[model samples]
Target chain A: MDETDRLIINSLQGNFPICDRPYLEVAQQLGISEDELLSRLQTMLDNRTLTRFGPMYDIQKLGGSFSLCAIRVPAERFEEVTEIVNAFPEVAHNYERDHEFNMWYVLATESPEQITHTNQAIEARTGLKVYNMPKIQEFFVGLHFQA
Target chain B: MDELDRKIITATQAGLPLVKKPYAALAEQLGIDSETVKQRLRNMLDKGQIRRIGAVPNHYKLGYMANAMSVWNVPDDKIKELGNQLGALPFVSHCYERPRFLPEWPYNLFAMLHGKSREEVADKVQQVVKLLGEYCVGYELLYSKQILKKTGLRLKAKD
Candidate 1:
């Protein structure tokens, strides 16, 4: 990633314009042409520098639900269990953490009750306990990383 | 959201097209005008249904390899004040108050700290420790070993 790439990452994290020529407007602000900005963004995304490039929807506000769930898989079966847990379409984000609760993932469902439904399905499949840690309150969410 | 809005979301949820006229592309796909597509997105943004429209970078790939979810056991009454303070910190990305399962899990406050290395993360944790002081009964830094999956917020399409 060059200086221009860094500038693109930092500038476009949020508040991207909603106009017809949004990219053109952004490129102007960053002192780059629309074509250059588009190509840079495409390359960054292709290389996994930017995991996603689009609108971030608030699932809860849209009558959907989200819960952070974890599981403790035996060391030997970690990989197998990961495959099993991740097979569920509802498991949006999963991670291997350094703790007893080694596996952590977020479940995004269409409704509040689906949160429980998905957890139960995972437990039934994995035969391991799923700890659901739904947020009682959200204090913050947005954070920008200077690339 | 109406059916048209849902169609717009389903079309762009993956991403805006990498084209000169991205919204127009979406409109073309949905068989709607560019103006309507832009207006629905704007409306969703206004209603907070859409947080923002932009790039979501991979922090690990961006050199923020050391990201720790710092969980704290703080008194329920003090959480409101403490969570806000932690959230205000530039390094802390996400902060929230969650339910704690005693005996196994005892963390009510969760703050995500990002850094270039574990040492940097530990240093930030110290800042949080000092900020919490006596209110924090216990804490743990769960460093992620791997990102197994990270496809953000996918809504299943209607049948």
Candidate 2:
């Protein structure tokens, strides 16, 4: 990435303007034309450098529940267990980590009750205990990656 | 929290379109005026329903591929103070206080760190360790090996 690309990513990490000509406003600040700014963002999105560009909604506030759940799967049954856990659509992100609790995933459901239901279904299918580790509190959750 | 709110979310959850007047385009599709769309978005932002409206860069794609979930077992009383300190660290993108699973697991603080390499990440982690010093009883860095499934919130496909 060039200096301009880095600048765009850093500047637009949050607080994107909400107006008829938001891009123009951002462009004015960045010392570029609206078309140039828009095209750069477009290219970044298309190339997967920027995963998303928009409002990040809080699912819990929207009557949904999200939790970080983990499982310890034996090496032999790792793929099988992953498949079983991922069968549920509520599973949003699943990762393989090098730890006793090898498999970690985020469970996102429309309702709070569904989180338990999904856990039950996962345990029933995998025959392994599911550890639901929801956040008790959030001290802070805002950061901008300065590229 | 109404039908219109749901529609607005489902419409803009993925992201706003890349146009000069993106809200106007969204309003046209939702059969609402540009002003209403803008106002509702502002309301959601003010209500904390929407964290922020902006671009989310893929750190991995941006060359900071080595990432680790560095969790710490901190004292309950000092958790908030330590957590705030950890959150303030530039490399620590996300910091939170979670419940401790005694006997088996005992981590209460979680901080996500990203860097260009594992060594870089480890170096940054040492900074956190020194910063937390006596407050942190124990800690572990769980580096993700691979992403099995990484789907962001999908409001429309499920519907």
Candidate 3:
């Protein structure tokens, strides 16, 4: 990514204007034409540099529940367990980390009760205990990556 | 949210149309006016339903390859004070207080750190350690080896 691309990523991290000519406003601020700005954004997104560009809805506020869950799947059964876990629609994001709790995933359910139901189902399928660590309190979130 | 709002969300959840008049495009798709689309979005923003509207960069692609979930086991009584302090740190992206499952799991505080290198992330963890000198009983840095799945919130059709 070039300097202009970096600038676009940084500037557009938050507070994208809501107007008829929002792109034009941003393009002017970035000292680039609307076409250039749009083209660059398109390229970055197409190449997977920028994952998304839009409103980040707060699931909790939208009457949904988000919980950070983990599982200590044995090395031999890792893939099998992963398949079972990720099959659930509620499992939004899953990751493999270097820890005893090797598998970590976020469960985004439509309601608070659904979280438990999903977890229980996953455990029943995999026969592995699911560690549900829902946040008691959030101090902060949304970190801007400076490209 | 009303049916119109749901339609707007479902239309734009993947992304806002990458066009000069994105909202107008959305309005056209949803059979609504540009003004109404913008107003509802604005209302959601004000209501804290929408955190912000903008580019969500992929940290790994942006050179923040070394990311760690630094979990801490701190005194429950001093959690609020420590959580706020840790969360305020520039390097700490996400900080929260979570429940501790005793005998097996014992971390209540979670702070996420990201950097270009593992050494850089470890250096920041030292800062966190120093900050929690007395209160920090134990901690673990869970660096993600791979992302198995990362599809952010998908609101199923309410029909």
Candidate 4:
């Protein structure tokens, strides 16, 4: 990652003030023109250097509940199970980890009850147990990778 | 749900200014008042549309030397209680319970613990084990060698 990539990654985490010319303001900080800043961000997204560029809402604070869930999907059913799990809007990220419980995903819902409901639905749909692992405690909240 | 909300998210996600009156600057480009931008952000936060708006430092650069994904085998009945207790720990950054891939894997609860060194992480795991006692049947610790990606969702196009 070059200087621009580093700058973009660093600024992406925090609150961007509500303003008319936010990019221009951001440009001023980078000592670049607003057009250049906007164009570079567009390019970064297009290249997939940035997986996503959006607001990361604190679900817990918003009266919703979310948990990290996983299942030991059979090797044969990996692709099938992944489709079913990823179908839910609540399942934000689904990954195949190198572990016994290979398939892992995140479920964020409006309430604790919803979490259970979603788990049951997933179990029924996939014929696999949805290990509902709600956060016991929060040790670290954010993970920002260096560009 | 509204167009402005969408625009604000798009703008912020794309990148925010690193200057004074950043909100005002955004407002100028978007042709809206800075206060409007601020209010929308506040609303998005309250509504759970966004988790947080803050700087996410690169831990490796900061020298947070050790990080591991720890899994525990706790009874279904007590999983919640244990998870809650573990999540509350200062060193535990990421915690969740997943189904045990029995016969192949037996652990259920998982936590991401970070420290300045491998020994520090091991020490914290010991602390967790002590707190949970017999409830924790067994555990394994997987350290992270690399971080592929750590950005928020776009909430559009992917669907």
User: Retained native contacts per candidate, as fractions?
Assistant: 0.88, 0.89, 0.90, 0.31
Q: Which stretches of candidate 4 lie over 4 Å from their true place?
A: A76-80, A83-90, A125-127, B1-34, B42-159
Reference-based lDDT, residue B6, model 4:
63
Listed models, DockQ each:
0.73, 0.81, 0.79, 0.19
Candidate 3 residue runs with Cα over 4 Å from true position = none
Compute the interface RMSD for each candidate structure: 1.8, 1.3, 1.4, 6.4
Over A25-103, each residue of candidate 2 has an lDDT whose tens digit, in order, gives: 9999999999999999999999998988999987677777889999989999999988887788899999999999899
Question: What are the lDDT figures for the candidates, one per model?
Answer: 0.90, 0.89, 0.91, 0.70
Which is superior by TM-score, 1 or 2? 2
Q: What's the interface RMS deviation of candidate 4?
A: 6.4
lDDT of 3 by residue, B1-159 (tens): 878877877888889899999999999888889999999999999998899999999988988988899999999999999999999987788999999999788899999999999999999999999999999999999998898988877777688
Query: Which of candidates 2 and 3 is the stronger one according to lDDT?
Result: 3
Question: Model 3's CAPRI class?
Answer: medium
Could you tell me the lDDT of residue A138 within candidate 3? 91
Q: Model 4: what is its DockQ?
A: 0.19
Lowest lDDT block of 10, candidate 1 chain A: A56-65
B89 Cα displacement, candidate 4 (Å): 13
Count clashing pairs, candidate 3. 0
* lDDT (Cα, tens digit) per residue for candidate 4, span A20-86: 5666666788788877776776666666665444456554653457777768789899878878887
Candidate order by decreasing TM-score: 2, 3, 1, 4
